[model samples]
Target chain A: MKTKRIRAGAAAMTGVLLLGACGEGGPGGSGGDFTDGKLVLAVMNDQSGVYKDASGPNSVKAVKMAVADYKKKHGDKAVVDDIEVTSTDHQNKPDIANTKAQELYERGGADVILDVPTSSAALAVANQAKTHKKLFLDVSAATMELTGAQCNKYTFQWAYNTYMLANGTGTTVTGNGDKNWHIIYPDYQFGQDMTKSFTEAISKAGGTVQGTIPTPFPNDNFATFLTKAGSTNPDVIGTMQAGGDLINVVKQFNESGLKERGIDLAVGLMLITDIHSLGVDQFAGTMFTDAWYWNMDDESRAWADRFRDETGTRPTFEHAGNYSAALQYLEAVQEAGTDDADKVVAKLEGKKVNDVFLRNGEIRAKDHSVVHDAYLARVKKPSDVKEDWDYEEIVTTIPAAKAFPPAEASACSM
Target chain B: MNAVLQYAVQGLAAGSFYALAALGLAIIFGVLGVVNFAHGAFYMLGAVTAAVLLDTLDLTLWWSLLVVPVLMFAFGVVVERLLVQWLLRLDPLYNFLLTFGLTLVLVELVKQKYGVSGLPYKPPKLLSGRVDLAGVVLPRYQLFVFLFSVAICVLVWLVMTRTRVGMIVRASTEKPDLARALGINVGRWVTPVFGFGVALAGLAGVLAAPFRAITADMGNNFAIILFAVVVIGGLGSIVGAVVAGFMVGLVEAFGQAYAPTYAQILIFVLMALIILVRPAGLFGRKEATA
Candidate 1:
């Protein structure tokens, strides 16, 4: 009887300890630790699918790195309670991503949604952000419509956009020398926006768009398109294709022996990930525009070095953009002294956000589009590469004023 | 004139890939009486295997071409024994449903494993550059794909007609009960026949890697088109499949060239017109009951 009583007492103690552990591990644990209260910043980015290889995982890592840096800088008195990062596989579907964003906001308490690659999905999430009164920092979606006709007060385009890319690279190249263009674009919103922006910029800069071919998305074979491009025989082939589509087209163009045909490729927008996969050897001497490059300057290089050390891969434009957006948002929140959406947005507007990724960048009051310098880069030859990840040469830095389309050109009423 | 010739050549080159993929679908359906929806998945796997082999084992295109098919053949055998065997006793619809589900599982698994940026595969050095054909500059890789696909189709035809195993399988497909009663052991032949079908898919995939992106979801679109090809061609007819594959390729090529916007629509329209004209397809056997 005595031994049975002792066993029951031990069981009771075990149950108490288990209950205590569960309580402490719950969502509302350690409430008094943060004087300003913890602000949960949920990051929802594409963690799988086509864009996964380019921006998904890296975007998440970048936000985490930025949060870590913020905490280190603020020392012991950092108002940030804890940053909780969660992601979803949008699979380039707007409906799915929008739904996931809503769930993240309502239940997950996501302060900001970052690096939505697909424009359609970005627009959907932006609408949700407006409804929920949350900050939506768009890091990757390139469609000008996000800041144009569909511009929301809640959404801020932090990185590059179609207008900026076209104006910076297409117009600059066409204006300088190569006037006539044979363009091949994907038949989609992003592609349409890119082609329109490029054509308009080229025309405005006294250049001619001789021909344009609109191909379907995820088109595997571009032999026919390349042939058609070659037949046009313009001074330059302006490719607005991105990701795998871009690589396939460029490779096929090279293999078509058209490089010797005097039809140089003027890439409107090329990501470092695409170049890395395709190899710089084949893409040598090609001029393109990018929002960020790892080897841009000392500060950029240092940040890239640290990022590479942590992530084991070079920081992509979208990845760097995520960092920029997160850091800027955190700064805005700090300045506002509250998590209220309007107050934070007010603090963010026209605020000069100085970071390793971007310098002297300010969120535009009219459209919430972050204005920053874009780099015109040429692919470095194999011999020029002193090490891996050193694949680009910054040809010129296009100023913010000349990089993006004029506000008057935008269809946004605000 | 030069521009027209270039477009034609380009069309034929792309048509070759569609033909190759369609031919594989045709062979699997013709021999097994199973609408292998996972044929395109096998094609995708073939390309991915080649890319992975090239990356991991430092294998060249030649080695990958040889090795990938064998691996896929083994995968086919396993699939047949484990999943397809049960459906063989059931209706053809069951096989289709099973294969469709299998495709989803395989594609999702690949996505989970690889995370879909699409691994790049380089063409062999010999077939890397372009060659001028009658004043039309053509990608050498495309030319090779066309030639390779034709060779494979011819080879498959030769095997189906000449070999004893092919004769038995073809005979069984035509008269399953008779072949079974004659002690041909249709059960024994099922696994190898399935393996051969899978091998054809793998071959198409090996040929495709150099031209297309090797993504997990790459097969989904191609599979739907392959189904259309099978319907347009006579079901279970190798000759019909070959002819229809090239025919569809030409149609798609010309359609895209002439009307870029309606190219995809034109394919379905052609399929609809063909179905309306000949319910059994271009070479399909008309049902006596119908």
Candidate 2:
């Protein structure tokens, strides 16, 4: 009888502890139950599709590393001890991303979701994050809609956007006297945004878009499209495609005598790994906007070496962005002493953070657009490439303000 | 006139690959009475094998062209013996479904081994440049692909028509009971015939490696088009499959060149029209009941 009574008492205590943990939005709270301080970060991106190499499982590794780095730096003074990181592959689909985003926030209790690549999928998550009042840090997807029309308080886009690419590459190329542009874009939100932004950027810089071709996503045969574009023979052929499609487009474009006809090839947005995969010879003399290059400096190289050991590949800008975003979120939670959405958002807005990955990183308060220094890199010729990954030569550094459009231009009501 | 000629030539080149792949599909369907959904995956395997051979083994494109098909043939034989032969006596749907599962398994296996990123592959130096006919220039690789595909088709035709082994295999597939009653061991030829058909798909993949983005799911992209080609040409008609392959290719190319946005519907529309006009396909034999 005495032992039974003791067990009953223990059971009651366990019940009370469960209540404390469930105090997140429950009635029994002192304003709010900040008792259970657990940080769960979920990486949401393409893990087994075209965008996988750029972000995917590597992004998960990057997040874990950032968490480790955060703990090492703060030690006992760290934000939270109970931290967990998880991931889901969206497969570049908007519906799947929405479902995963909901599960991550509602059931899994993720504090932040990182690295959604496809714009349509990212937008879906962005809307879900806003509705759920959760944090989403998009490290890769390029649609400016994230910070423009669809932007929300809980979502922050960390890397380059379509506007940044348009301003960086489109305007630069136009200013260099490539007056006529033929833009071939994948028929998706991201690609369409790239086309729109690039067209506006070029026209504003005194260039005319001769034509815009909306090609199928994941299109392998760009031969006919190339021939048609070749017939027109515009001064510049702007490829607004990404991943495997981009590789094919660039290859066919080069082989179609457009270059011999003196038409320049301008990639609206390109990852470093793409140039590496295609080799310096194929994309030589091509120009594009780059978010981050792994071999940019000693700091970058050191981080990249660690990343290489982890992933067996050099970290692309998207992968690096995941690390930086995770670290920033942790820092914000530490500064605010809470992982509450409002508190974290307040802590992140307009704060200048510096790390190996981002310099002068400012998460814009209005549209939650993280702005940092961007660069324009031109593909190095085969003779100039000293190493395998030595594909791009940094042409010019773009200031944060100049790279991104003004915040007022954003249609986001946030 | 220049645009028309350009689109035509380019379309024909793209069609050649579809033709090669569809020919393999037709042969398998004809002999096995099974729709091999793994056809595209086999094509992808061919391309990836070439990539791995070049990147890891330091082998060249020529070596891949020479060796990969033979390796693929061996793989097909094993797959046929272990998996496909078991499903032969069952419903045809069983093999169809089995091939579909096998395709998924193969695709996932490739994804696990080599992540879903595109790999780089350079063409042979001999086929690297453009050929100028008048003022317009076309890629030399495309021209080579066209010529090589035509040559392969002719060789396949000659084998089926002239050679003893090919004649026996063709006769066995077409009139299995008759050939079996004539004291021929028709069962022995089944495995080799399947392997030969799979090998043809592998060959097309090797040819496509230099042009398409060398990736695991690259096959899925081409597979849908190849299926349309097989359907339009008739399910098991060799002539129909080859002709339909080129026809679909030309249709897609012209569609993209002219319509651009609506090209997705062009091939399907053509398929619908073809089905309406010729129920057994342009080359498919009419049913005795009909």
Candidate 3:
């Protein structure tokens, strides 16, 4: 799969110059717009790494579905005749992402990039988008910087961020009497952001921080950190590691008899796929914040059913977010009557959206964050699971206003 | 003090996999003189195979520990005969590149079959809980892994020291040209020795199947750390691999416990120090360095 993605990239690189020449000669080759005939939506993320399951090829599939559904809905009124989706594996490396993002914009002829997952890698691609003046809808990465200091006119943080996750889980968990907290986070931009956000949320909810431990990114083992966290005798241990790292921590915590020792785990961020991988029993009764859940309502269930038919697995929040972002981007293109980044950005800014994934979603004009209602969900017991992948039960809803940081707080001047 | 004991036990348990895999790397480097970059892939394959066996045939972890290594041994033998044996006479870099390529191919193939989400492997219920001894609490499986890997290391060490076959293999490993000149048929042991080394890696993989994430790229980082383990253990030293394995594990544990940020960096620091003090590794024979 990795080799295939590389081969595809190589092929695209070879065709770049020729494609660029042809694009300039097209009908709408004016200075104000750039749309040859088709719109290319490129999905770049950790295609073959730990985060793959959450938003890899499945995200690509969701993008394609968005195009198809758009075509079906608009029919003759569709702005673009065709929408093409392409994807590549950044392998969760920022340097690789920078190169691939450049390639996607220069030679790959991508109009918009979708679902760049890792916070650092996503930020790298955001820089490329800003440079190339292309749209980048970040559906998966959880860093607030994309909407803060690093925010760009060309990039949109679509699904969720560390602020939303920490606000939902940290406050609720601390408020439940687990006041003393020890945090273990992957030592990266996303992890650091999650730690800071969770600490803020915990303190706001009348709690004191015990300590915070930084573990290696993409690390397989967490025994040492778990031991260190336990040494402090905290009421709750908050883990900011996600995907495979989160699974390992939860598994190791279960094995270390920490739950029996009465030390509760507060997950900073979690995905349905992660819960499915470790089984519902391991994470049963655990509370975490979710951007979207497949079984939330009838409309969501219907979309998820179609998604299951396509991918043979239930969709994570990221998959739904990708679909929503892609569809919204296309709608914005239709509203603006062009694939030009500036026009699309104008159309999307401050737009209120209600879709299967984004409930009460608003594309804020200030920071480019698509703020939406986040759900505080608890993992159901194994017996409570009525069907496969039925993992979460929504406990409460954190409104859009409370879910994300206010627009004035953003460091982005634009 | 109890925390110290806990960290030490935890470190040793974590070291069990490294020790087992490094022993295989040492053996293969010792005899075949081929740096098996595919060793980690083989370790990944072992875990994948064990998970698959459990899923399809309902084989338990007990069965996997016994069955997976044997399968890996045969796989190693075939790999030697079909691929590695031909590159024996070339520059070791050629073989290293070959194994490196093999690692990619194997990893991609596994990823194709099992999506990157990783497979689930639950340890036996008996080994699922914790064991408390004198106020120190440790996972039951970690304790089992530490003890089991030590037993296998001792058994392999005994065979190398006592058995005629092992003696011949060791002679060839210690001095291949000299062994040939001394009327020992060193070439005949090449295939099995490689197979045995691979089996040790496979055995380690089986031990780790329940303890770690069983994914395709699981071995990518592992292989890197393993190289550090090998370098610190002395490239081709048998005892060094096992000793350095546990030693690195203990160091990693203590470092992680005390300095969580610099835990992984500490392994390389220790390796660099060992290399500076003794170019041929801690227990490596001086002649082997040449």
Which residue pairs come into collision in candidate 3? Answer: none
Which pairs of residues clash in candidate 2, taking residues 3 or more apart in a chain or in different chains? none
Best-to-worst order by lDDT is 3, 2, 1
Superposed Cα deviation of residue B160, candidate 1 (Å): 1.4
Please give the clash total of every predicted structure, in order.
Answer: 0, 0, 0
TM-scores vs. true structure, each candidate: 0.91, 0.94, 0.94
Model 2 chain B is weakest, by summed lDDT over 10 consecutive residues, at: B281-290
Q: Per-prediction DockQ scores?
A: 0.46, 0.72, 0.59
Candidate 2: list runs displaced more than 4 Å: A1-35, B288-290
Query: Per-residue alpha-carbon lDDT of model 2 for A270-327, expressed as tens digits?
Result: 8877876666677888889888888888999999999989988889899999999999
lDDT of 1 at A13: 46
Off by over 4 Å in 3: A1-34, B181-183
Tens digits of lDDT, candidate 1, A32-68: 4321144666666667666776788778888888888
Fnat per predicted structure, each in turn: 0.52, 0.69, 0.59
Per-residue lDDT over A279-357 for candidate 3, one digit per residue giving the tens place of the 0 to 100 score: 7888899999999999999999999999999999999999999999999999999999889788899999999999999
**Candidates' chain A TM-scores:** 0.90, 0.92, 0.92
Better of 1 and 3 by lDDT: 3
